[model samples]
Target: MKSTVEQLSPTRVKLNVEVPFEELSGDFDRAYQALAQQIRVPGFRPGKAPAKIIEARVGRQAILEQVVNDALPAKYSQALAESETNAISQPEIEVGDLVYGEPLTFSAVVDIRPEITLPDFATVSVEVDPIEISEADVEDQLEELRQRFGTLTAVERGVAEGDFVTLDLSATVDGEPVEDAATEGLSHEVGNGELIEGLDEAVTGLKAGETATFTTTLVAGEHADSEAEVTVTVQSVKVRELPEVDDEFAQLASEFDTADELREDLRRQVSDSKKYEQAGAIRDAVLESLLESVEFPLPEKVVEDEVEATQHQLVHALGHDDEQINRFLEAQGKTREEWDAEAKDEAEKSVRTQLLLDAVADEAETEVGQDELTQQIIMQAQRYGMPPQEFIQQLQNANQIGALYADVRRNKALAGVIGEVTVKDTNGDVIDTATFFGGNDDAEAEAEGDDA
Candidate 1:
């Protein structure tokens, strides 16, 4: 077998493949065996008919058609491997006329990964916000901690922000009571805004045993996106009294024995959190910078397929009901046209990023270790709220473990590039990416030793 590639475009190609008649021996044997089982002959058990007899019964033309159909997939795969073509979309195949003794010839047109020119890593630069922890930040964290240890006390007044209230809710749309819209003894915070829109404002300033009515849009169930008149009856109101911030309170809340020591610890925690945020910003900024510096044509089919897949996932999650999907969009204040446009834009960006990272991985020869793969699996599982073992099994069942492996390789490639690029904070201080990117550790150590 031999294959030749015809470059149709930067992102597409045509593969012309030819196989000699001698190579059809194995294909003919398998095809005959399959046909024998399907085509019954008198005085012979199933799959026991002679190949020549079956061919005669089915006609030589039929036999050749079956053989070509059975061999095209393997032949196409082999052609791709030999030609080193990275096909991103399914092929459109056409086969030429086949004579009994002539070679098999076919051609496949496919979308492929485009050739990308990578920018020099050392020339890329990005700026991120500096990590800043102020006194107010530390105090805010301490206040949240104190709230965790707070005690709720019955208040003999109107509901207010931060007040916990017990209430009963009922709603009606067009004077008809909505199904599953009535509940009693529901506990909610006055200003949380978690239950539904307009609930907080309706209940605010309302005293215990008082009721207030307001209009709100239902966000879920059959009545989603419908405006309903909701009546909320406040059963009781209570205020949370936080513990005093003192040495005794510090011992009660945390292991630290002094308030000053706890404040210092809280400051450190806030600083670490800010540093994490800064690192994420740096990574995104550097990626955006590279995206701007590099230019390449993307495979159109790849982008279109990604966009379709994203929409399909949403439709599947909504139980394949178009009405429910539209209601969901309405609740989010988005039109179907806007959603489609946004999906397409996002898909294009995602495809571009994937292509860029894949090229980087190949150029750098990035390697993903077992530990790195496991760590990535664990992180993804946590994001999806699944156990690592269960997530691995699911990935295997879907045959998506290779996709996860590719993700890890791409991440490592980007991390290596980030380490080489110039990254600075908005304050104009050079940021050490080694700590976060896990690259250039030995080099940093050597520099430290030299300084010593």
Candidate 2:
């Protein structure tokens, strides 16, 4: 077999292959043997029919078709390997100029991954929000602690901002009930925006017999964008009376003997949590900035394939016409082409991140302790409402070795990066996990977005 390659584009190639008479004759004989075994010729025994006799018995076209089906694949593959091409998509094959008992000529076109020049990575820098644990933050955390220990009591008066209400609710779209409508004895806080939009306003002054209806779009699963009318009635109202932040209350709530000790512990926990949040933000910023700094061409077919897969998964998970998906991708600043390109780049980045992290883990000789994995698995199982032993068994049964390995590598990589970065608070003070990542920053994020 002899092959020649032509570069069509960075992502595509054409291969011209010529197989001489010797190999062609052998393939033809094999094809005849296969055909003879499948279909018995009149007087010739099965698997013993001569090639020329089989060709005459079965039409010439049938023999040629059988030979083409059996031999074309191997011939095309040989052409690809010899021409040094790794196709991203199936090839288009065509018979070229040919001669009997001579070289069988054919050509194939295929898509391949384009060569890329990765930009310098080490010099890149990203600006992240500084971790700042303030006195107000500690106070806020202390208040949350007090609330968690608070008791709920039924109230005879009107529903107020901090009051929790048990309500019967039903929502409809256009005039029809939205899938399995009514909710019974649902406990919702009057001021909490956990329910549908305009719900708080409707529940604010309503009594057991009173009902109010308002409009809002659905937010989850299907019917996400459909305008719906939500009817809410307060079946009952209750207010949580938080215990006084005193020494006695602290002793009742926690192991701490005094309110001061409890507050101190809460402050320490909040500070530690904030540190993790800040570190995560820094990591996200760094990766995003790295992506922005790099400019390179990717294989078109790979990008397209990634795009199709992403879209299919998105549609399957979020429903076919999920406008939020479009909005989400749009918010990420992507057009179809841009998103396709980004998807393929994201695949590369993911693989590279894992590879680099694994290498770093090897260099540092890092490991995930059995106890740590056990704790993680236990926490995840509890979070997902599954039995811990069952979840662990499921993980093993499903062969999630790669997932566990990835989790370990990711933690090691982040820890490794943290070691290099000089983490600091907003006032240029040294920051640690004990002071930066635990706040309800998700609320702050939304508020910040609304303000923007």
Candidate 3:
């Protein structure tokens, strides 16, 4: 057996392989065994017929066809391994010749990972927003806490912003009632804008038992993208009565005994949250800088597949309705052509980023330990609202464990580069990334144990 590779392009290769007849004996035996189990013979039991007898019964052409079909995958894999090509897509194979006692020849064309010239990480620099927690920020958090402890009191006046209302909602398209669009005694908050569009404006200034009708476009169901007249009738209105922000309230809301202590704790929490936001912004900036400095050709098929997948998800989310898709694009202030172009651009960027990070991971020799992988799995499970074991099983069923491993390696690779890059805040101060992303061995060991 022998193989040779031809470079078709920077991101693609063609392989030519030839296997002598003597090398295919194992394949031939397997093929014969498979056929013997299905074909009946006068003197032989099931799966007991000799190869020569099965071949004689099935004819040489049939036997050869089975052998070729059974052998292609293994042969292709061998050729790929020998050629050292990192194929990123399925190969297009063509058999050239197959004759008894002669060499079997075939050729395969596949997409390969492109060679990338990485930029120097030391030269990369990015500016991020300064971490600042103002008094207003702490106050906002305190207000949210207060709202959580607030009591709802029934009000007799017309509905107002921040007031909760019980209402009946019904909609009609072209004067025909939409069954799924009708509901009775639904609770909604005025000015929340969480329900149908124009609902807040329609319900405002309406007292109990008063109805207001307005026209808005339906976003889902069979009538999606169609204009509908929605009627909202308010049954009752109630306002939230927040507890006073004093030392007594502080004790009830938190472990702190005084309002001043509670405010200080909230400020610290806000500062910690801002640090995380700053770190994220820095990471994005660094990646963007790296991408802008590097130039490489992407595998066209990979980009196309990514773009197709993105479009498929978008369409599926829109319920596979073309009209709804158009309406969504319009609502987003984009045309169909513009949206397509953006999707392709984004897909290309995504592919490039993955390839770049993978190369970085290889260069940095990033290792993803079992503990790290488990942590990633747990985090992803939480994001998807699935149990850890269930998520792990689903990943195994889908054969995505390798993907997760690669993701962890790529993340570690990026983290490894953060030390080499310069990061500054908007106030012209050199930010200390170590404050947020510093590696703590003890913490990691504890986390690993917890995960285990």
Candidate 4:
């Protein structure tokens, strides 16, 4: 067999291959023999029919077509290997030059991985808003904990935020009950907007057992496009009763003797969480910088595929219909054309970042130790609200163990990259990495603004 590869673009190519008759002769003979065994001619036992006889019965072209159909994949694959071509998806095939005692010729158009010089990742630096933990942050978190442990007591009072209210609700579309819509004795906090829009406003002033009705279009969610007439009846009113912030409350809530100690501990937890978030943000910034530094022609199909996946994930996140999602996408400044144009770039960036991180991992000899991997799996299981061994069993059952392993390995690689990069705060000041660095940018900003 002889092969030639023609580059149509950075990510695509056309492979031309021809197999000589001598190579195809064996495949054709086997096909003819299979046909001979399947059909017996008069005066001959099964499988004893001559090749000429089979060809005469089935026609030469028919046998050749069958042989080519069976053998083309192997021939193309061999051609790809010999020519060092990597195809991403199935090839578009075309046939040519069909004749006796000659080469079998065909061409395949395929998508290929893009070839480019990787960007200099070592020099990439990113500035992050400082990971700062403050007294107010600790206090705010303590407040949340107090609220969680607080008691909800029945109240003959008006509706207010942070108060849970039990209500019965019903909705209709076009004066008819929506296909599967009704609610009874639903408990919702006044500020939680999980129920249909305007339900809280309509039910707000209602006394116990009092009812009110209103109409509104659902926000962009699973039922965004529809409008419903909702009637909400207040079944009960209740107010949360939080225990006083004191040493006794601290002892009951956690391993602390004083409220001050509990607040300090919660501050540490929030700070650690903030550090994790900041690390992620910094990684993203470095990756974006690295990607921007590189210049290469991207593969169109790869980009299109990535863009499609991104769009699908977005729609899945919205949990909405395609029309509503398109509107949301439009709001994000993404048109069909722009999405298509940007798809390849995004895919290339993702691949490049992974490759760069892997290189760093190699240089640092980073590995997810067995103990760490096991602990990671356990943590993931806890996140899923499942037992560790059961989660591992489920992963193995679903053939996702390899994926889990990959995730652990990739995280180790990213950690190596993070270690090498010097991160600065948004103000160009070096961050005090040793300090108990925890801060919420939004809340901190609000506090700073208040002081101003």
> Candidate order by lDDT, highest to lowest?
1, 3, 4, 2
Error of 4 at 142 (Å): 1.7
Better of 2 and 3 by lDDT: 3
Model 4: weakest 10-residue lDDT segment is 433-442
Q: Clash pairs of candidate 3?
A: none
Q: Would you list the C-alpha lDDT of every candidate in the order shown?
A: 0.91, 0.71, 0.90, 0.76
Best by lDDT: 1
Off by over 4 Å in 2: 17-113, 118-126, 170-179, 212-231, 244-265, 317-452
Runs of candidate 4 with Cα error greater than 4 angstroms are 24-60, 97-101, 218-228, 309-420, 427-452
How many Å off is the CA of 165 in candidate 1? 1.3
How do the candidates rank by TM-score, highest first? 3, 1, 4, 2
Candidate 3, 183: how far from true, in Å? 0.9
TM-score of each: 0.89, 0.59, 0.91, 0.73
| lDDT (Cα, tens digit) per residue for candidate 4, span 5-100 | 998877789999989889987898789779988997999999999998988998988887888889999999999999988676578899886777
The alpha-carbon lDDT assigned to residue 89 of candidate 3 equals 81
Clashes of 2: 14
lDDT tens digits by residue: candidate 2, 218-326: 7654566678899887888888888899999889988999988988898888878876777787667654554455444455555566556666887777566557668
Name model 1 segments beyond 4 Å from true: 34-47, 56-63, 97-102, 330-333, 441-452
